[model samples]
Target: MSYSYTIQQHVYSFPDLKSVLAKASPFRTGDALSGLAAESNMERVAAQFVLSEIALKDFLNEAFIPYEEDEVTRLIMDTHDNVAFQEISGFTVGGLRNWLLSHEVDSQKLAKIAKALTPEMVAAVSKLMRNQDLISVAQKCEVITQFRNTIGKKGHLSVRLQPNHPTDDLRGVAASIVDGLLYGSGDAVIGINPVTDSVDIVGDQLKMMDEIRQRFDIPTQICVLCHLTTSLELLDKSPVDLVFQSIGGTEKTNASFGINLSMLQEAYEGTLQLNRGTLGNNLMYFETGQGSSLSANAHWGVDQQTCETRAYAVARHFNPLLVNSVVGFIGPEYLYDGKQITRAGLEDHFCGKLMGLPMGMDVCYTNHAEADQDDMDNLLTLLGVAGCNFIMGVPGSDDVMLNYQSTSFHDALYVRKVLNKKPAPEFETWLHNMGILDDTGNRLTIEPSHRLLKNL
Candidate 1:
């Protein structure tokens, strides 16, 4: 249905739910580049106003992408928790926003209603939220997942030790891994985005990391960010803790990445059979970002942010251990500059957490983008305050292979110290035992002769 609202006799109209959502989104380069953003500030405000009055349940009745046309839509519709929705069944999107911000809705209330929320519903409500509103509400919701260690626990934050290398050199990759670990990072996982997708190379990397884990008896997992098929091919030969994939919101977008839901399901089931997890069996790591659908020409006119939330639905279905939004890495074409990038980062984190996925942020930007280290520091601190599950711990905030600037090992230390956060429980204990961190868990002890160094 077409939606319109009048302000001082000027009527602003949107042609459909999808159109309204696109127009209502906070100004970003992606929507504007796609010609889906509102034409004027007043029009944008009007769309947000109209969306607020739209009933929350109206989203349930309308599918942005027809269920028959999209499996993500079918997955959202067919598996939605109708029973849990009863709590807020009759509310409008604006009402849900107000209720979410009220004292009546605590962590438990958010968790209870989490499964009832659809990507569209969350995306619509997110449009009405300020950056602070996104952070505040997200801070109240908790989504914990476990593999070798638990993530997303309250009062604790985690970091994915992204020890990436330009070449698939075991010694070089292992060096970054050791550096990250020494700084009390990598509690989430020691993940490396390999230079190649070769199954043999990735298999060798996994074996090397696993050997390090075994030698140090570390309470963490290891992952080589390769294609799902490559990961599956080497599962028998290597120690794979988490299956990695770069998934998008639309089936076509996923297909562009050489992936489908069934492939993801098979990988999930295949990883589970390995029985490698000591803590829990959450066995997947999926990365998503805004504009991916548009980048792949598969958004079908939906806004990038909404398309991004749909990716969360896919992640939620498998109960993945971590869902990271590599925000700002998509370049200035989608996000434009630091301001837009910060907003998208906060919005993605909020939407993913509300969908009950363990969410992390790769607070990063490319060299050509109109961004710098200060912008990243700001986003990183805000994410810390938002209780983001984890972030990338890259070496010196630069990826020689990927050619991007991300949060560094020192960045993790700063956020943790400034936010008064600790690492995962098991990892915190390991740090203390290794004398890398004090018993109070406040600062790194920097033991020069640390035993883990000998393993190198």
Candidate 2:
């Protein structure tokens, strides 16, 4: 069946739902590079108009990657809540949008319908939303997850203390961690992206961070951002607080990264057996980004943002402790500039939170991209208001190992201070105990001669 609407005698037709979704998406170079973007701005408007008329259940019947060929699609179909979907069974995409934005809809109401909604449905609705609309609705939906520390509670924010080093230098990485901790970062987790994916290096890094965490008795977790296979190999021999992997939107895309649904489940279960978390057991950490499918030639003709939404389904299935989009890290090919990157960041956070994942963001960009610190400041501030679970806290806002610009220790402090958001509950207590945070837990009071330096 064809979908179309008319404007001033000009009939805009979409051959299929996929085409309609592709054209309706926000302007991004990756979609255009894939030849999936709207031909013109008017066509995009027409597509959005047609999409608004699409019924919510229409997405249930259509599979972008077909149920048989894609495991992600199959998981979506198998896990859908028919009973819960009945609540919105009669809604059009536009009607769902209106209902979502209404004053009556709050965090609890959205949570009830979250599992009933598919990623495509959420993604489709997201395209119809403005930047502020995304933020407003996301601000109302609270999806919290935890491991050793509570995160995603209202009025709280967390930072992944990313102390990445070019050579995986123990002392160098340790110094960065100290900086992050003193700055009241690392309430989320102290995650490191090693120069190599070597299991030995990953294990050693895990041990090093764990030792630091133990000496201070910090209430946060630590992870080495390596392949799930590497994590599994070293899980027992090393202190693996979290299992880390790079996931994507499609079966082929994930396969290109050497992961499948079963492998992910195995990694989840394997990490759970260690039982390392203090306050909770949520301990899988997965990272995703737009353009990953396009980069791997596995997007299957879908727009990059929609494909990104599908990756959220994977993260949601495992009940992950941390699910962050390395949004701008994929570079300008997928998200062309600060404008596009900012849009994608808001959209990812909105869609992920709606799909019931504890969403965070790596508010970052590459040096080659047409973005700078100012753009990041805008995105960070917006995400902070949107109640994003966490953001990356790299030293000096630059990753020596990954060689990209990201949020830093100071950035976290600025957002938290201006927005009146505090760190995770457990971490805030630790900071107060260490005298890094004042009695109110709103301001930091770092001491140069703190005992933490002696250990370092």
Candidate 3:
């Protein structure tokens, strides 16, 4: 009455084994078996018998463990080169389920290898592993890192132009401003805020690069930063001089964490295709908002670690893939209130653990967010040594830019003579007297030039 054998608590019969084999069959390959030769009943049975015998021998050899005195060894030796049965030898009915679920086996190959595995193995493999999309994630990481590096190193100055300006005129002004600054000593590439003026950010950047190639001959590349919309659009139109997207607002929403990241990935993918040469050679800046909190030092502050974590995760996730540059713009933890913020407080926010490596994502001091002089000083002092490559701000006077540079360089002569004085001497005077300084100067005042710097 009991026509089955029980092994390891499961009943097995000829019919049961056939049903299990049918289930373990390879995933449907659409049309691989359409043209088998038409034959009579006895001929078909004979062909099937030959195939089954060959497969059975292989299955016994691969699926069964070898012993000093074993029939399976003899079977494998007999069916040595049979492709269909080869895989059968590798799996056993009892262990089939476990092997199927293991990393060693792929779901797609199940049916092909079933001859070697028992019904139990096929059932187990089918139930265990799910499809993973790691390849896409890894591609995204590589793209992000490439963009970041391009924008990070070549960028020296940060600019914010009114969105309405004509592209040609804007480029000239940008060129002039940058040329003027270069006349002195610093290699400043303008950083622009694109969110405030989308068109100006995108249009002028393309125009400026075109003009630079046409009008002037600067040996090195000039860089600028733009908002997301402009960046995405410009990435399509021309080579991005440099582009950065602010990650989040003061609040934590799905838009900041999820949507923007998707947008970044999309643009990055497109940029890779559109870019002719190496895209990673340019820098991709990550200009983050002020950390969400009352304290300037908290990584996420009010926004909490969720915001910083997301940001750091993006950088950490991408850094391994990008070949060129990655820079992080970190804002201070507190709102600017004149001289209330301290250097130590600045350090906590500026030097605190945020994400990625310091060299990978350089910090940008943004307490200057309100353009407070003291806050600017605090940011420079605390974050400068911590490997901050850029200072985002508007220059009130040439003196301010000069002061920032002097502080950055820790120029002993300029510090002792100029910043350490009762009334700050004219920047030109300090330059003239200090043999290391250059005499060339620009007539940048607080009205227009300062306005350009303010929005940045």
The 10-residue segment of model 3 with minimum total lDDT is 134-143
- Clashing residue pairs in all predictions, respectively, total 0, 0, 41
- Estimate the TM-score for candidate 1: 0.98
- C-alpha lDDT values of all predictions: 0.92, 0.92, 0.32
The digit string of per-residue lDDT tens for model 3 on 1-456 reads 112334456444322222222222222111012111212333333322222323233333333223243322233234333475465455433343344335655423533442333222222232121222111111111111232222222112211211122243464445444433332322223343333446555575666554543353322223445555666766656656444554432223324333354566665565556543233433344533323311222222112222222233333222322111111122322323323223222222221121222222222233233334344454344332332333322323222221221122222122223322111123234334423233332222333443223332
Which residue pairs clash in candidate 1?
none
Alpha-carbon RMSD to native, per candidate? 1.0, 1.0, 23.0
RMSD of 3: 23.0
Query: How many residue pairs clash in model 2?
Result: 0
Least accurate 10 contiguous residues by lDDT in model 2: 439-448
**Candidate 1 lDDT over residue span 353-417, tens digit each:** 99888999999999888999999999999999999999999999999889999999899988888
> Lowest lDDT 10-mer window, candidate 1?
439-448
At residue 414, give the lDDT of candidate 3.
25
